[model samples]
Each structure stands twice: as C-alpha cells, then as structure tokens.
Target: MKKLYSILTTALFCMLFWIIFVLQDINLLKLDSQEVITGIIVSLIVAYFTHRSFIKEDPFWMLNFKRLGSLIAFIPIYAYELYKANWDVAKRALSPKLNINPGIVKIETEVESEYGLAMLANCITLTPGTITMDIVEEEGKNYMYIHWIDVAATEIKEASNTIKGAFEPWVRRIFK
Candidate 1:
C-alpha cells in the first residue's frame, strides 16, 4: 500500500513538473499524443527511482489537504520575501556608503523535525542580508548560525525574531 502510494505521488509530481517545464503550455487539449506518451514514460522511470525518499514515513500524510494548503500559502509569502530582500540588497549596493555590519549570530529554533529546521535554514539563507552558516542541536534545541549583513540584534530571541520574520510559523505548519 505504501509503495503504491509513493508511486502515485511521485507520478503526480512528475506530471506537474512536466507541465511546467517541458510542456510550458497550460492548454492540455493542444498536447500531442507523443508528448503525453513521453511524459508518462519519463515520469514512471523518475518515480520508480525517487518514490522512497518522498514517502519515507506514512504515505498518506503528505496527501493531506491541510499540508497542501499550507504549501500553497507559503509560495506567495516566500516570493514576497525574496522580492523584498532583493530590493533591499540592491538599494544598499547602489548607495554611496556600504551600510553593512556583518557578523555571525546564533538563533534558536523551535522546530523539532529535521525537515522543518532545514526549510527554516534555507529560507533564512535565501533572504537578503542573512546566510545560514550551520545548524547545531544542543540540549534538545536547534540553533542556526547565520551570517547577517547587518547585525541588528545580539540576543538570541531578538535575533531569531528578526531573522526568521514570518517564515518560522509557516514552516512549522508545513513540516510539523
């Protein structure tokens, strides 16, 4: 049952990828027979190799509507953050004075799952002015060491609040 679920999930994801990347067209009625055949063949091969990693635990968990909704919601929020960060970086770069106070700071995370922590770290790194250096687990807490272009806060809680912004909560919902 788990294997079947994994195969189905992988095939679905591959089909979505094919539509977005290979097809590059939204009109399904215009799709050629050859293209449909090719998509299925390629997706099946890819699914066979990648299914295990995606459905390591319960296969049905990922198919839940709540998690799917969270993922859909997260996309726009991430995009907005990415755009804002890029603009901020560009402004600082164009300015006469380099207003960067760079330093590595440790920020604690409440996310217990490895996937959740990884998502948080990646999100922080993607944001402008911050790069995640390392994630360390100490005394049952996860701490992310990040290099900040501007060190606004020295304390852990304040720094975490500043660096994480709205990402942590969404990630927690998605991965928890």
Candidate 2:
C-alpha cells in the first residue's frame, strides 16, 4: 500500500512538473495527445527512480489543500522579496560609500524533510543579494550557510530571520 502511494504520488508530481515546465507554451497551456502520452511515460520512469525520496512520511501530504494553497501563495511572496532584494542590491552597488558587508552566515531551519530544505535553499538563492552555500545537520537541527551581501546579524536567531525572511515558513507549510 505504501509503495503504491509512493509511486503514485511521485508520478503525479512529475506529471505536474512536466506540464508546467515542458508542455506549456508560455501563458497558454496547450497539450497534444503525443505530449500527454510522453508525459505519463516519462513521469512513471522518473517516479520509479525517485519515489523513495519523493515523499518521506505521508504520501498524501502534498494533496492537502492548505499545503497546496501555501505553495500557490508563495509565488507572490517570493516575487515581493525578489523585488526588494534587487532594489537593495542596486542601491548598494550605486552608492559612492559602499555599505557592503559580504560574509557567510549560519541560520537554522525547522524544515525537517530533505526536499523542503532544498526548496528553502533554492528560494534563498533565487533572491538577489543572497546565496545558499551549504546546509548542515548538527545536534538534530538544520542549519544553512548563506552568503549575504550585507551581514545584518551574526546570531543564529537574528540571521535566520534576516536572511530567510518569508521563505522558510511558507516552505515548511508546503513541504513539511
């Protein structure tokens, strides 16, 4: 039963990604019979290889409406953060007296699953003026090393709040 759920869940997720990334023609999502056939076959194959890590505990977790809503809600929040980061970076770059303190800072995360951790790292990387260098596990806690253009706070609590911003919470809601 669990194995079937894993395969099914993985395959469904792969199919969703395929439609969003591969089959879509920009704003309009058009799909032919050939594309549908191809998507299913490829999704099944990918799911077969990746099912073990695709889901951790509950296979139906992603199907929850609230979690799915969080995933959808993250887009605008991410965009807002991107917009702010870009402007901040631009301002710092154009300033005559450079207000830059570039360094790597460690921040702890509550996201337990590996996929959630990856998602958080990727979100941090996508935003301007910050890049995730590494994620480490110490004493049952997840910590991420992020290279920020400006080092706001060195302490773990402050740094996590500063660098991660809105990324971690939404990711936790969606994935964990």
Candidate 3:
C-alpha cells in the first residue's frame, strides 16, 4: 500500500512538472499531441527512478508532499516581492546615498530541516537587498548569516522573521 502510494505521488508530481514546463513554453498542445505523450512518458520514467532511489527509510520527502499548496501560493507572492526588491535595489544603487549597510548579521531560524533551510536561503537570495552568506548549524540550531542592503534597527531579527515568514508556515503545511 505504501509503495503504491509513493509511486502515485511521485508520478503525480512529475506529471505536474511536465505540464508546467509545457505551459511555460506555450507550445500549442492542440496541434502537438506528441508533446503531451512525450511529457507523460518522461514523467513516468522520472517518477519510477525517483521512487526506486528514495523509496523507504526516507519518508521525509513524502512528508514534504503536503506542502504543495503552500509552495504554489508562495511562488507568486515571493516573485512579486523579489521584483519589487529588485527595483528598490536598482534605484538605491544608482542613488548618491548608496543606501547599503553591507553588514553580515546572524539570524536564528525556527526551520531546522535541510529543505526548510534551503528554501529560506533561496528566498533571501531571491529577494532584493539581501544575500545569504552562510548557514551555521550549532547546538542543534540553524542560523543564517546574511548581507543586507539596508540593515535597519533590529535588522537581524527583522530579516530573520521575514525569511521565516515567507516560507515557514507553508513548509510546515507541506512537511507536517
């Protein structure tokens, strides 16, 4: 039963990716039934290998499956935030103020999983005005060192919370 579930889940995820890729390319699926069939075949092959490779003893990947909805909701919002941040940074860079603090600060994050840490780090890097320097895992805690364009008062804490706020709840939905 578990194996069946895993196979189905993996197949479904692959199929989703295939569809997204096709739609992104905006290739006319109507005239090109071949593309659809090819995508399905590819998705199936990818799913089978992925399932075989990570099957059993590593349930966390599947556990993270529940976060799909969160991931969907986050992407658009984060994209917009990143776009806004880009403009802000561009303007700041061209301005006389140069508005950059260029400091590295330690931010404690509640997300402990490697996936969660990675997502948070990527989010920081994607957003304008910030760059993730390093992730420090000590005493069972995860801290991300980030360089910021504007290190406002309580900067580290605020940025930490911002990073967490972007994806933590959604990740919780997916993983737990």
| Model 3 lDDT tens row, 46-153 | 777787654544433644544666777777877787787889889998998766766667888877667667777888887877888899988988888888777764
Winning model by TM-score: 2
In terms of lDDT, the poorest run of 10 residues in model 1 is 53-62
Candidate 3 achieves a global lDDT of 0.72
Against the correct fold, how does model 1 do in TM-score? Answer: 0.84
Better of 2 and 3 by TM-score: 2
All models: lDDT? 0.88, 0.90, 0.72
Backbone clash total, candidate 2: 0
TM-score per prediction, in order, is: 0.84, 0.84, 0.67
Q: Decide which is better by TM-score, 1 or 3.
A: 1
Q: Give per-residue lDDT, candidate 3, residue 68.
A: 63
Sort by lDDT, best first: what order? 2, 1, 3
RMSD of each: 2.4, 2.8, 4.3
Error of 2 at 67 (Å): 0.2
Question: Residue by residue across 1-176, what tens digits does model 2's lDDT show?
Answer: 99888988999999988777863464424567786898899999999889987777888997799999999999999999999999999999999999999999999999998889999999999888999999999999999999999998999999999988898889989986
Candidate 3 clash pair list? 66-174, 67-174
Where in model 1 is the C-alpha error above 4 Å?
A: 25-27
Clashes per candidate, residues 3 or more apart or on different chains: 0, 0, 2
Q: Give candidate 3 misplaced runs (Cα > 4 Å).
A: 1-4, 23-38, 52-69, 72-80, 153-159, 162-170
